[model samples]
Target chain A: MLPELLQGVDTGGLLVIQDSASYSGRHLLQSFINAALNREEAVHVLGFEVSEEELKDGLRGSPVQRLHFHNAYTDPLGWTDHPAFTVHQFCLGELTRLVKQTSHSKPATLVIDSLSWILRHVSTPDVCRTLQQLRKGGAVRSIIGLLHADMHQRGTVGSVCHSATSVITVEPAMRGDEAVAKITKRSKSGKVIQDEEIFRIKDDLTVVVQSKSSKGAKKADSEEQETDPTANLTFNLRLSDTEREAKQKLALPFVFSKEKKTALLHSGPGSGRIHYEPDANDDYDQEDPDDDLDV
Target chain B: MYTELNSILNTTPDSFTQGEFVLLSDRQSDASFLIHHFLSLYLRARCKVCFVGLVQSFNHYSAISQRLGVSLTQAKEKGQLVFLEGQKESLSVLIPQENDTGSQAMDFLRDPSVGLKNLYEFVRSAVSSNGEEGGDGSEEWGPPVLLVDDLSVLLSLGVSAGAVLDFSHYCRAIVCSQLQGNVVMLVRCDGEGEEDEGDDEGSERLMKGLTHQCSLTLHVQGLPTGYCRDIHGQVEVCWRRRQGDGQYTQKKLFQYKVHDKGASFFAPGTSSAVL
Candidate 1:
């Protein structure tokens, strides 16, 4: 998982950054498209390095078809000659157009790869607000944005996170040579509107999926030879002879003097607020609607 | 097997009976092919069955029918035959006019009167004319089945999701109203990408209306990253009452499959029998 730390963050859109060589990234991209089409097709997004042959070979025996959106950084040969606009512009235009055209009655699913780049070109805030509007507009069958994890440090990622319906984090966990697949939920706050709640309840918990490996296995050998709880005639217990030595050490003082208090006042509210619990509801109930205003 | 299909299709054992209509959609090639094959075989002698490819030639239909050694003419005569390609086009796209197809175009679907009558007539003529010639005319089309090759085509072509869902809901309403025939809408979501927040929203909207419109609604998802190639799915059924609180109750149907075979509660694996 290139964005390992982004285990539970849904910055609305996705940010996918992988080693490029790992086919996992490619598979992940394909999964997004597949999810959008309701898994009717094995459609996957074309990456900067993806090839037609690879797509065909990988999607062998799958029903999904590819709908390639234009890319500017790549495919320059076809960029200027084929269409009047660039690839990114075309993709966003098509996406936005799709959102505008779709109906609210039926469901639509939209899957886009790399929101980070999309935002870099268009302002992040615009993308955020546009997504919100599109969702409300009901023109989208569905909308899913993919982003790389590293982009979270950027200010825009935080803004996007606050607006998403749900967020899912996929990452790799390794202990020695063994690997564990961990799926973390970031979109728990998103409302459940379908049959997914049943599946989540029955199957969402992490299972102890054991791999066929024993190199790093640790065995527990403690056994108390009691066959039946009440039938036991005798019991043997081991008592360890432990020794204690008296020792004296200076105790650290937790309290600060007046000088420290003065420094704390100057330090800031963060430290000062930690020392007390203010009544948040104190004036909330007592406030009168007729109270005078500065206006 | 043919007996069961005949019974479900609501056709008399001896009299020529038309097949029921079913719609199956998904992008899993193997799944789409399997569904097509199963429906074709089941509806073979009793009904005409053909899997239409989006990019593949319509002639492929004839070829498939020939290879199966099932007489397409016989199927057509019985009003139990149908084939559809996966191409996405406008409502006005020119549908080829053939003697067999009287008015199955978009206009006909919207109005349904002339087209449905014409369809019934075509079936009657096909069955009465050819079914009498052979001793096998009494054979029922395997089962009435409609297969939608890919549902995403409707979505990608900019078809209103609401419209597609409405059609599905409409089919269910009609089926329930008739109470004799069954309509199955097959939607295949292959992997992780198949599940979208938007689909959930749409499903919620459908559910709001489904209380009175449908007897059952099943959702399935395929998993590519597990010990089991396909994850076991759950089917939730909700029903509405004519009186009382009209509150809905949900029950999960276990052991559903989500994979290349396409997800459905109507059929399990290659078996035509619904369990």
Candidate 2:
């Protein structure tokens, strides 16, 4: 359910991943990219924050057939004329053409490694329009933009988030190794769905979702498995009521009763005697009274 | 290099690790002494250094380094240090030097939107190239270190925070990874009392981003107990080391006092002058 909600492929609307400086949303971004690739949808990543090599290294083992990484980081301003992708091409016209030429008119998932870059560079309204166009523009299936929430104004962050169909916010969890993702999605019928889950990114770039119920249930299951070694056996290991009573009544000979205590307490200092008690499991001979006769 | 700084960081004088990024940040106090320490440290270690001076001029830094025992003038004369004087460059060659074309290390000054790619390219070439012209051909020069002073000034100069971060990243990739060198960047941040100023997210994000990526973070801030004559400021150094499969950080706080010759670092509350 978490993956389905994160994939956001059923309704196909604009999806936004909001992250702060402390926690990164790149793992979620890669999850969406992985989902798109598994479903055979072409993925076009317009990376501006991290370099192309870094992004590629993160998505190293994933499918690269439909994965197209646009290089806005290298020569963003055409200063050196590197002939690569620049930051100025964040508009609708250029993206539509790239989609048309790459996936042969198939709708692709457009991922902005970060929308904060474009939002900071371009106008907020213009960026929103481009987002709406790319999502409803038919060539793109769903757009996932990573918004660094702390990097933009509250109004700009709000308007951009308001324009999206699904918003996933990634934050550091209580544990250092885990992150919490709060997902809010708007269905096609305008129904708002909200969810929260714990997740961790594996070394292989795969996201492992850890729901609360599943975590508790796993603890409970492991507890059940760890208990009662005598649970399954051919014979009954438990005792019935009569057997328990008999076992309790059949005591050994070392029992110290009230009379024995009183007798021992009232004894004088010179008193000396052999107090004998027979045990249930003790072996005794009837002719033990000087049968050897040596003494 | 000061032994106090090196010992606090738990680094030996001989062992060299490539691709190390050291981040210097200050909240309520000036942490430029750390930048000076790193400068003289690398210079004394025989590492080829590229100093990008945005806050102070070459003479200002040279004067201070002379006290610390390394001569920047002699280092530059030996082709060991490449200093990009940002203040002088911005004042002299903003528009009139289009035909000069000698070194456009400050090209971001001309075009803000173009970002700091040119600045990165300048640093890359300066450090990546061979130092045979400095003197010897067979001599092995140490790892190249790129030091940027006052990274916040770039944001004030019309360059965006994202671009400054990108310039740092590209420099790390090429200078650190490609050239097997290190990077030391100093950024100024707001104090704890300063918050919610509205629309200061650019610098705030830059500070947070730099803190997130750097291997070592040394945060210098003014003392919460107010001003003191014996102690200048307190520095919190966090050294992260990875062993086996997990990583843990060793965090320590030190009180320091600046002197005419060099700075003194000691454990907090152990200052003899304070007593």
Q: What is the number of backbone collisions in each predicted candidate, taken in the order shown?
A: 46, 0
Query: What DockQ, between 0 and 1, does each candidate earn?
Result: 0.01, 0.13
Per-model interface RMSD values are 22.5, 4.3
Q: lDDT tens digits, residues B138-180, model 1?
A: 5443333333344334444444434444344333322222222
RMSD of each: 31.0, 14.9
Give the number of the best model, judged by DockQ.
2
Per-residue lDDT over A71-104 for candidate 2, one digit per residue giving the tens place of the 0 to 100 score = 7765555655464666678788999887777744
Model 2: CAPRI class: incorrect
* TM-scores of chain A in all candidate models: 0.45, 0.69
For lDDT, the strongest prediction is 2
